[model samples]
Target: MTVHSALPDAGWAFTDDAGPAVTRLLDTLPVRPRLLGLGEPIHGEELFLRVRNRLLRHLVEHEGYRSIALESDCLAGLVVDEYVAGGPGSLDDVMARGISHGWGAFAGNRELVAWMREYNQGRPDGDRLRFYGFDAPTEMMYAQSPRHSLTEVRDHLTAWGDAGQLPDDAALIDDLAGADDRWTDEAAAMDPSRSVGSSPEAVRLRLLADDLRALLMAQAPRLLATAPEADRWRARLHARAASGLLRYHAVMAAASPSRYARLMVTRDTMMAENLLGIAAREADRGPTLVFAHNAHLQREEGHWRSDYLDQALIWWTAGAIAAAELGDRYAFVATAVGAIHHRGLGAPAADTLEGVLSTLPDDPYLLAGRRLATALRTADLAPVRRSDNTDDHGFFPRDPAHIADSDGILFLRDVPTDKP
Candidate 1:
């Protein structure tokens, strides 16, 4: 490895002039991925987001990628989509309401949103870019009330020239939802006693949500046939949001031993569905750029330790499922960082993925995972994993075995943070 430690000439330097690099990477791919996921090691890093933004632009301009998805609330992303597509809304309001998990405040996300809006200016609908959030609307801190999604579905149906076909009571969903506090209780995440998932109201709501979902699906053909293409898409989104939120609420109210795991899996499952939906709608238009954490986008099984439960949790990620379903049409590039500020992470020790990549004399670069893994094997340096000592939610270990499963790896030597 030392022989090739001086950064192989095959990798592309991370810079503003990344169009050629992206083109090369796309051309070199054994299979064209309809969903090209760019995974980040950590969140809130401005550099990572900006780099992703640049790459997305390149894919859109050159490779004809039409959609950009992120690790954000699927329902909330509608506001963002509307804004980017020249809808009525101020940037501040869109940032506040369109983004979830408090990510809208990040300078990187703000810049991306602004640039997307600017890019859409004067572009025809066919040439315009679409923004989407692939995560469930609920958060780890507190799940949002399912009222918005449920009511949105009802309202859309009512306007569809068939209010009589649905439930007569406008207050039915609100009444069933009850107080938002019941679902958003923070302690319920770990303590079964605090959860109301099995409550009678919740059970009833589940049944009703199911009925509503079935009704929407049954009527979809007729509704879609009568409406314009855009209206049809909007109607489908409303249906998805309603059903997805109901399912999320049902999970939130669960009091089982596997509640947390179910929630985790459910969130990712929703993400996968949303992604596939986008692919179905826009695959003909272009590929999609999915920006998310490595854990959510990796093809390998995801691993994490829960401090609340004092045990490890492992599950399949959205990317893995997509890869399985899409076959070679889903490509993933996991980002590995060598150092981070505030978390005390610095120059990775040799033997680790970061450490091995750090040997290459580049601030940032893209390495073909298989080639890099081969080089590591040649140098007799086994790739090591990162430790889970810090409480950083963005941190995850990159097992070397994942190289065979991944299309490429985006390596950053250091992460820039707001440390003074």
Candidate 2:
């Protein structure tokens, strides 16, 4: 396995000239090339199509990758539902169906929508491309209270002694009276400040409810890992820390196996290690594409300096260590999306566009939709902003510096036509 560090000069330098460095590194690979494209703006639909068609051709025809998973939530179920309902359908059809059938919202760009529409349009229902949902809650809560395992919660809801009838408050009270010891322990651990109620039952239920939701969201890696081989499902656990429910604990336990009994250690790490173990067991299965955000995939030992250092140091570092221990059957791809102009979470100003365009090479295609270039040309970039908020909250300046260090890029399929 080769480790390609994009920029060797500076540890934390962000620049716009990352393409050349990435190209140079990729040219040295011997296997069927795994190329990650980080796109710059292009004017027309033709350019967008050219890029996407090339990408699809490479992934589907050349590479023999049967499954393509996105960083989306519950998308797999939708794909299955669509397949079951009819077969292949358009992007608009899928969205309409999702909304009408209470599927959920499509949160991102039109590129994905367009891609789905085009890819699945003409294919037969059974022969249509396969898609999988990445995340779903495996656990649930009743109001806000002590947590219960998904099975336990489901059972409790089912056995209210009223056949096919939903339980009322009194039934719920009786159910809680017979709750497990773990639920009680978890309830006692809640911080009083955040929870509103002072009563023991109320506090217990609230904390349990919160913890149950947490547990449900945390079940991604485990469920993915243990899914039956016949299910034609492939799972990718991509996180830097043991932050996720199953994989994190599994890796941690695996790292120190002797500290705990073999059975205990296995139990701890089983969910997280499920995918890796399954991959090892079924080496003949078709390739599964697991694209992690930058922090999870970057090599910890080399490329000590990173553009995402401020953004994801702690998690990235830990994930790298865990990945190393897991061995090297997996291909780790680090993605670099192009530079973004931060519009400070308000109305777009004219100057911001000019600053972004100024850094681009002189091309009519690149400047086709630019309305802010004239205003930004004269603006000063002196006031660099800082925020203590670690969360992906608030707006900030669109510094091209960050994109400059990216090893590769992933472009939006559709380039916006209308600009304010």
lDDT of each: 0.77, 0.32
Model 2 per-residue lDDT tens digits across residues 242-280: 123222122222323132232222222322243343334
lDDT of 1 by residue, 1-420 (tens): 254653575467766778876776777687778999999876777788888988988888888898899999887898899999999989999999999989898878888899899999999998888999888777875666666666766766667636678855445888878888887888876665676666777677666666666667777776776656666566566566656666766666666667667777877877888888888888778999999988899998888777766767777899988888998899998888888756667677776667777877666788776666666665555645554446564577578766757678888887766622
Q: Which residue runs does candidate 2 get wrong by more than 4 Å? A: 1-27, 30-54, 74-128, 135-285, 296-313, 317-339, 345-420
Candidate 2 displacement at residue 47 in angstroms: 12
Report how far residue 4 has shifted in candidate 1, in Å. 2.5
TM-score of every candidate relative to the true structure: 0.92, 0.40
Candidate 1 backbone clash number? 4
- Top candidate on TM-score is 1
